[model samples]
Target chain A: MSEDHVPGFNTLSIHAGAQPDPTTGARATPIYQTTSFVFEDVDHAASLFGLQAFGNIYTRIGNPTCAVLEERVAALEGGTAALAVASGHAAQLIVMHTLLQPGDEFIAGTQLYGGSINQFNHAFKKFDWHVAWADSTDVSSFEKAVTPKTKAIFIESVANPGGVVVDIEGIAQVARRAGVPLIVDNTLASPYLCRPFEHGADIVVHSATKFLGGHGNSIGGVIVDGGTFNWMREGRYPTLSEPCESYQGMVLGETFGNFAFAIACRVLGLRDLGAALSPFNAFLLVTGIETLSLRMDRHCANAVAVAEFLSSHPKVAWVSYSGLPGDRYHALQQKYCPKGGGAVFTFGVKGGYDAGVKVVSNVQLFSHLANIGDTRSLIIHPASTTHRQLSDQQKTSAGAGPDVIRVSIGIEDKEDIIADLDQALASA
Target chain B: MNHDSYPDAYIREILDSCRVIAMVGASANTVRPSYFVLKYMLEKGYRVIPVNPGQAGKDILGQRVYASLSDIPEPIDMVDIFRASEAADGIVDEALALEPRPKVIWMQLSVRNDEAAAKAEAAGLKVVMNRCPKIEYGRLSGEIAWAGVNRRTVSSKRPVLSGGGFQRLGLGKGRTSN
Candidate 1:
């Protein structure tokens, strides 16, 4: 099928990168649950290995089912191409590895997920990739943070747990001025809430383990290339701009045109890093994506209701959901995620730590799991868990406080959620 | 019920004595209560550990910001939490798994988990719920200068109209009470 004939979100999610099985006419995408594909002859095998032609070389690099996921996600995100990986962390690593070398730096929002903060602060430092933290609310801070060594500017469209929305276009303008690409983690917002590409992001990434998968069953990640960044124009990104011995000296930008960075990510990053998503997980994620629009609509509506409930609750000290009019990021959310503010938010309980704990204990519906973006409502206390690794000062900076509780609102009935929360707050 | 059925007294003691805690959620941004309370705690000298993942390994209030409680490498008497409730279990588990478990698992004002609290209590730990140690400490230790019942005189002086009232303060008048 051609791009023009491709259908809506629900249709494309199921059939975007797949067709009926050529041999058996199977309606569903089959999990190519094999390590390697066999070649017909020696030359054909050599061509596959040499990247002279496209064929599955190893599951570590790519798989047929995972390819369908990548394609479907790319289409959903309005990107030229995408790569599915083992986890959201791996997706980030792949993008960074392809974009940065030792001594290269990236500017990132301070309001990112706590794990991402740790990755950028400590893990990425191991690779000598420095990250300058920028206040997502302040675009000028991003501009000031950029230097000659800066390769990318990264932000989360709707920051995890924090629920702060980034000004993608404003920051993208900064990246463009600095001759670098802007990468937005669209995990919390998802393509359903906001397509980062539409607002000027050069690339979008997701921890498909969350909303994209809908259920809390699988862990996966995806990187979508918006094909907006001009790698060759300024020669800032040599990995894509220059020729490579990795693929027989093929200059990615010259060969792949707009999708050069994404091709580089697959051929170089995923190939070397070996963080390929499993075919089974890919299939699950695809099924989840098929209901993305529906789930997101409900998620947003439920989240707004929950946020309002929390904000009004006497026990809630503060609520930080972009859907709320008083939220600091509400304006940015309106500009970026006009569809809806997303399904995650943070609120402080009135009694501080004890009240926070009491509410968690009293809640019957919300799952007390370590993961988010589940179809079922999820909640966590960051100061005690996810952000526990950080010191008191660090926790405050990350917006995880002793009194704060984070919620990843699900697509359940809003009334049920509010009722549960009301009882929990009353009990607390 | 047996005497053991009662919660541990050590937990109560830790919760009572630990004032001026450096809650990692202690914000430097004044608008953020974390900042005010952290400053309040610091002024009170109970020792605050600001645990922000973003600022981990950085300095907050002249204190080194460690990532996790275990990473603190020092004797932290209490683990006052500000994370989500789902995250509490893992943190409690981690705290229990520590070489020396924290004296109290103080779930922030609105945070709570009975299973986690029970787990900690089962492991000879103290659990406090629906309370801010800072406020309690202030109220109990005479740190709060105001004279009032339940500290409402000082704390409630700022008339935050409930959700049901007419829009005098931008908040509803009396529909909801906190």
Candidate 2:
């Protein structure tokens, strides 16, 4: 469809990246399960490999089915281009690989997903890439953390599990002053909740494994390049400004113009890292994305009711859902996620640790799982699970308390969700 | 003892035996309460499992990290929590689904959820609320040596009579002690 015919979110979700099969008239995106595609001729094959042309060469680098997903996600996120990857972690790795080299550094929020924290803290250390951790709640912290080596400032649009919302505009201003790009992980607050690009984020990433898949069936990730960051003006990014040795010394910035960084990620990063998304998973994710607006609406509405229910319950000691008026992040939520804060939130049981366990053990409707962003309700005790690797101090900083429980409200009937919670709390 | 009033003995035994907890939110930062409580639990020998999703698949307190209670893939007698009440429902739901449901569900100080508690109780799960497991364990295990003395000597001695009782005592006379 043309820009003038761009449809609404729901409509675009279902039809943006695909149409009926050109040959067989199949409605769904077909999984090009094969590993390689035949080229039109020797010149075409050479051009594909030389970046002179665009076509699928191998599944390891790209695939026709996955391409649809990338296009749709890029369109949905309002980005110039996107690259689908194996996982959210892989997406970060690929983005960093394309943006940073050994000895380069990046500034990131302290309140990021714990796995990302570990990746930046330990795994990235081997690559000699340093991360300056800053408090997402404080823009000044980010400013202080930025150094000459900083290539990007990263933060989650809404922090994971903790449900803390970052001020994208404020951070973007900081990044602009530092002459670096702002990379926002819009995983928790998917585009449906808040579009980070609209708020000045230069790049957006998602663990399409979560809400993007919605069904908990697929594991995938994507990076959406806003095409706003000027790589040529910045002498710092040699990867983009200089000629790439692997691509016959092609200057990505000069060749790709608006989409240099994204193209670099696809041709260089994914090629080396081998983190390309599978066509099958891409199809599943696209299916989930089709109902994105609808599911998010229900997820947010149910979460609001659940947050309110927990806030008022006698058995609830505290509630940290931004949807609640008294929550510290409520104002930010109103400013950012005006429709409602994303479904995930935390609360403490009145009777302490024992009660916390009891409540978790009693719920019948809610699934006790580690993953979030599912259509079904999911729960976990961070102190005993996802954050167990962190010390008490680290856990506290991450907002995972010993008596705290995390819930990802699903798109189920709000009354039923509340009822299960009611009974569980009573038993607790 | 009122059998209905006091927690079951088996539950008490289970609570007593557990040591060396991995509390996911065991905040090492002193400002966070979980820090002190985790330290206290560690001192008490209860292996506190620290399970923060953000920090998952790592090591805390020299113990390998697990992403969720189910992910532990080992015998965890109890799962202590310091999360919000809304989150309790899902945690409780997960706890019950365990192969051998946890012995106890302890909500930390200032945390509670009646429905979760009731559901756990119905599922034959022991539940405690508005109380930290570390504090309770210390108190019940005699680790808080002065707790009894403080309760008896300090609290019991302070007799603030209710309005109805004060009237019955006829305090208006300002009677001297004979």
Candidate 3:
């Protein structure tokens, strides 16, 4: 009832940007399963198109269903605005597209999702947008990677496959000094564990397909604008600072202050790139988010138990779960994700690649697939699947080495999860 | 006066009750934020007096533009500062000096001056900083949801179209309208 009363994480996850349906009185966020919305008049239509008013013209750019998800995630992340998109790759692409020009570059931590490393090193190069790789653990490496051509710095809150908890604050300082926005892929931590914005990230990205849509039934991503970066000052990001040619020459930075980046991505990137999240997927993702805190709590607790079980196993050569006290990232895990080490972590098999494949084949309860952050336990030999495109050195740097087996611990009882892993390890 | 956050009631009361608004540093450029915001308020049926030294005695969106807040002949209900933070200090002083001074001092987005806000609050004026009124009006009115922005309030109330061709659910508390 009071505006001063800010909503808590769990409360916002359920109701942040939603209201009962005005026309139909639907209680749950009904999928407004339409491609376009009708305008009030010609003037209204012009205003909506000209950016003079806030109204939906097409589902490609904005939708009521997607808007609620955007708002919920934004509130959870402590960001000003957010854009919901098709996938994590789409979110990354839209963000980079908005920030970089043909020759411009961005710095990314080497310890990232294998797909992201591929996207940065291979896919982004087609646009002539270069990515300078830096070590996620070493903050100085980010500073050294920054060149005059650098427009942004990218890192994962918790590196995928590797289970490395990055020093976001340390790297954020490097980003601040370089006068670029720090883009953190918070796919694993899921706001319940690590809020990148709280630690000085300028923009927070999520692969909602994983933890956010806990059921693994949907594929969606979100880009939350922290509203901290100034895009207009030096004319560095012309997409925001300069007059937009397509949209009545409205300089988005001046027109939509604080939330300008989100607007720019929506009007420029999503509007053009055409990778949009379906309303049904958005509804499922939002529903999945309702129990995010509950699922994440159980997932982390089970993960620690699984990590402990694997670390003591004779068949395991080494484990990379930050939840373990002896693990190298324990201190950082404490600092950033005190909740637990997170749901996913990796361990090396004694016999390397062949043994890892055997473990995947032997697991019964854990689904051997290429995904994380699902309510169901998933196992993958990333070297043979997700990271197969990368070179051997690149695979090791990404924590997807030939010997590594990654498991996404589920909300299921710990005993069942550990038994499955135990039987799988024995066979290996 | 914590400018960090504003209660929904505090903002709603100002938008619903304050009828006349004087937009300081109002721009003529159509793409500028001040221009569209003024247009939005005008269309929302509020009497908005544009204050700009560069374009005086002319009209902005058909409202007679005044050189300053002091030059406006009629009583002003609120002074929306669209200028930089440094310029808001002088505008607040000017608003405070006016006879029957305005009830509210609203600074536009990205404009924050704590000292000026404190000074204005000392004079019994309500202050809102680093926010957009058009955004708030649309938000409180629940019309911003039309554009995919988070309206932040959930309610059972349905929207009713106004004579001016817009829906005003008003604030979320079931209080119909001003």
Candidate 4:
């Protein structure tokens, strides 16, 4: 409350959404492991149901521990509010459910996580929500692809595996012109590296399992409402604007103000979908965020060194990392994420698929895994594992070619990472 | 919402994309925040028109002052509200009534109105309540540092890349032909 003092990033990371427990004086946020909360009286219960006041009624809809994690991530991202969900994919489902009705269309960037590509291409078809793919590199493509039914535009702040930084501002403009909100998946570039809200994003999502959880110990995801989009605009998003019959005809946007979208996702999406994040996972994620700034700084530093090493290596065909001076997305990185281009990037092996497979099987320090943003180095041959089911064209479009080997640089000493990769490359 | 600070990136994006800004509650007095905000926006290459009933038929910052948003002849991309929070409703209503309604409704610092904001948003207009465009633009554009004051964050120059066959993901560029 001091007028002169403004909390810095480190301070906010530690104390933004938490205070000493009033009842027990616990400094750290305690995991309220119960399924429900006892109401003060019938009036208190009714007020909570009516959205007259903010209180925990059920763990599935809301929880104290998860609320702290939500507030912490929201503050970190400068978002109006946040909701923690079961996994990254669950977060996407909640967001899409809130935005799309049957037959509504949304634009998505081609360069995205393979799982997301699969989700958008196949699973969403069943729901009757169509996806129109656009090139993230060309901002105009988004405009060209827009139809009257387009409800949103989605892209990754820093794409997975390939470490390509997107033009969030450019696409946001297209979304703005089309009367749609821009959603950016900030899984790779956490708020420490890039805050999508600052770049005109209306909504931001994260796979807390990766960087925010930091240790690969938990599976979690979050949706942050930038509170920039107008969901009530001409009734495009009826779930938020129209009166909800489920809740006695309450209009969420009118009642919640700037945070309507987040409220809708929680009360409707999570409540019905039943993909709520456990309180235990929320506690772990909150703990992980305490050291996010420190870990991300080291991750970027190590990644830059590793990228430089790979780009110059004789056996490496090409390296894709925006932190590299000559990389294609360097300009985007500088403009969007000046801190660094993030820790994960991909490089091609000279011997193609066989060499790529050999490198992943050989690395000692870098664990061969399907995940990124771990505290310890991790590597995977996407073409052989994650993107294996896709066709050659789909693999290429997603930046997972047969020769590509992705590396997620950790906080390890840069020399050890490079030496491990060098040994793996020599073996290949 | 906190009136003191906002996400800097959002502010800069709005400033960059918007060309014509209609300054509501514009004043001819040089010392007022509205006058300076209008002046600073003009200096930043935005086509700012002054909207003040009292200043009609007069010039502020060398641009003719219009009585209200309806009086402006050109399309307005942004409507910067410099009046008190109480006056926001009428201004927003007027903004919404325009033939080609403005895309954004920006309330100045210390001016916050949830009702007006919700109304504008329902009509498909972006709203920034309790914030100032001039201060945000100066802060994010790195021009405020010239006054010898340091904000926690400052803008950095965009990266100049060494380009030749550099493509994202090394997997061809642009969309594939249908």
- Global lDDT of each candidate: 0.74, 0.75, 0.88, 0.82
Model 4 interface RMSD over true interface Cα atoms:
21.5
Q: In terms of lDDT, which candidate is strongest? A: 3
TM-score of each: 0.69, 0.69, 0.94, 0.73
Candidate 1 per-residue lDDT over residues A1-428, each given as its tens digit:
22123366666565556544433556677777989766646754664465433445678877767877787788788887788899999999999999998999999988879999999999999999999999988999998998989999999988876778888899989998998889999999888778888888998999999999999999999998887888887777788877776665566675554566777888889889889888899889988888888888999999988888787777788889888887888888888888899888899998887778787888899988778889899988888889989879878877888998998888888999999889988998
For model 3, the superposed segments whose C-alpha errors exceed 4 Å read B89-100, B112-122, B145-169, B172-178
- Backbone clashes in model 4, listed as residue pairs: A198-B9
Q: lDDT (0-100) at residue A11 of candidate 2?
A: 63
Candidate 3's TM-score reads: 0.94
A1-428 per-residue lDDT for model 3 (tens digits): 44555667888888777767666777789998999988788877888888887777899999989988998888888887899999999999999999999999999999999889989988999999999999998999998989999999999999998999999999999989989999999999999899999999999999999999999899999999998999998999999999999987889998887788998889999999999999999999999999999999999989988988888899999999999997899999999999888999999999999999999999999999999998899999999999999999999989899999999999888999999999998988
Inter-residue clash pairs, candidate 3: none
TM-score for the first chain of model 4? 0.98
Off by over 4 Å in 2: A1-3, B1-178
Residue A348 deviation, candidate 3, in Å?
Answer: 1.2
User: Candidate 4: which docking quality band?
Assistant: incorrect
Q: What 10-residue stretch in candidate 4 chain A is worst by lDDT? A: A1-10
Candidates 3 and 4 compared: the better one by DockQ is: 3
A364-408 per-residue lDDT for model 2 (tens digits): 999987889999999888878888898888787887878888999
Which is the better candidate, 2 or 4, if ranked by DockQ? 4
Quality of model 1 by C-alpha lDDT:
0.74
Error of 1 at A246 (Å): 2.6
